[model samples]
Target: MIQRAETEHSKELGCAKHLLLAIGSANVIGVSLPASLSSHAGPGAGQGRSVFFSDGVSRIRLTLDENSPVLIENSGETAVLTFDGPGGLISVEGFVEKTGCHCPKQAYITINEGCIFSCRYCNVPNLDKHIKTPDEIASLISDAVRRENVECISLTSGVVGTMQEEDERLFAILERVRPFGLPIGVSVYPTPGLSQRLFELGVSEVKFNLETATGKLFAEMCPSLDRDVLCNALKEAVGIFGKNRVYTNIILGLGESKAEMKQCITHCLENGVIPIIRPLTPSAQLSHFSRPLAEDILSISEFLQSELLRFGLDPSASKTMCAKCMGCDLTPMTDLHLGEVTP
Candidate 1:
């Protein structure tokens, strides 16, 4: 019985492996693989070897063979898999950074539970909660920034009452935090004439997440949102914050195509907005979505790095550019190029 259970477990692992691969492929190519192929026979001898190239500098090799088991190797270490069968071949490269930003002491304060639009993937519970007092929110920001290296603060609130009321509360919070001179970022649902108001309040950056690339998907996923409103807000943000200051978060593994992804990136770039790509992690209360494979993440990162290079942006320049840049951009420049702002 033990042997039989082990065999069944191996099959289940195989199914999981294929499911991951299928989801990854579908995310990249925008098509689902057939169930039969997604659950094809287990990895056998000579059938599973994968190479990952990151930023054309780092290489990772993974090998899976019947008797040899699985072996994964990076620049400095090698890990051997003892149990699971071989997984298939996958390769990805681009967008490797040596370091990341120091996240500031930040807190997300949800003021209201009332949102005008309902998005399918949102994790927020109901939209009818009471608004937290501006003084309370401001106190939280002060405490966070006082702790350690907190250079920026992000303030996010729900849309409740009138648009003017939301604006008033947001402005009040900003007013209280302004004394610290710390950069502030906010997530706002696009409303007519709202971007300018937020920018005028000394918000360093604003995020109006597009969520999905295709309009059809947007309609399906965010039934209550008006796409045109969101687009206009993004456009206005570019005008207000300058292209480099405006950022949009894009979640991968939402059944978007590589072509669509590229198009979205290109659009954001031209408009002076940066695309912040992150994988979708499943939540028990939400949908059971799978994250894109490692290769896909690496590939998207690489593409972003290349594009940033074109714009004269280096990965190490400024963490204030979303806390990714440390103090590297502040050092004295012996031969600095004109029009380049380090950090």
Candidate 2:
């Protein structure tokens, strides 16, 4: 009986990795953050603040929302995360990680806080626009590096103007921070010749989000953006950046079936681009959509892990962005271990 009980506990630990991801993809917390954590000024202030929760083995990022079923309470040195599961109330132990800027050990900065294209599901297009000057960008990165000991720098932006204008603006910012001697990554709406230009700028990695599993949904959700251009950009990125250095986001719960999601993952892997299976964050614009179930997330992520191994791609090899952070999704190598968890 003792041996049987030990086996059950071991299986639960294996599932625990997926369980943590489901909680993160749900992106909610039931309790108000204690003053110790809330006082820290970080990203997504206008929206809800986010918390990084790490079990000793893996970490997941969750947003603070009183409406969620999950509750986190501080213990002596760690926090107890409790939630009502199908069986009963389940509790897990971990601690809240203080990130360097937007994520741990990286200065993830946004160049433009607003977008010109009105993607119905995204909130950035509706937010008040703010473009950071080059000097301001340098100062922010400098501060994060000094205070947080950041190892990499990541830059993302909403398209606030013409594609050319945005690219030029990014180039200017890149020039200012080049001397910092940290690996840099950029995520932007791709333009012709953008990948080569970025490689010439000494960028270590690049990401262009496909953001949808199928072309039909892509057209419906992001009507103004061309899916073909995005696909070509991703392929081109793999060529310039080489394998394991290029990444893209194939967001889940956007009305895509499992087969479609797998096909999308296959396309990315075939081209040597690492795909991020990000869960949809519900918002006023996308109120009709719901977050994907934890089971669905785990199953799909398991498929991703297998395919990644088949293709010889490694998420751990990425130098920047969501792949490096592993906060927002079920990252393959870092979070999903194959038969390695033990009770």
How accurate locally is residue 155 in candidate 1, as Cα lDDT from 0 to 100? 59
lDDT of 2 by residue, 151-193 (tens): 8999998888888899999999999989999999998899999
What TM-score, to 2 decimals, does candidate 2 have?
Answer: 0.87
lDDT of each: 0.49, 0.76
lDDT of 2 at 241: 90
* Candidate 2 off by > 4 Å: 1-14, 20-46, 75-77, 339-343
Candidate 2 colliding pairs: none
lDDT of 1 by residue, 1-343 (tens): 0011133222222223322332321111112211111100011111222222122222121222223322222332221112232343322222212211112133334456445555665544332355778787777656555554565666565565676777777788778767777777777676777778877788877877787777787887777777777777898887887746676667666778878877887777667767666455433223666656646654665566566556544423322432232111111111111233343
lDDT of model 1, residue 202: 82
TM-score of each: 0.61, 0.87
Backbone Cα, N, C clashes tallied per candidate? 13, 0
Model 2: residue 5 alpha-carbon error in angstroms: 18
Q: In model 2, where is the ten-residue run with the lowest total lDDT? A: 1-10
How many angstroms is residue 192 displaced in model 2 relative to the true structure, after the best TM-score fit?
0.7
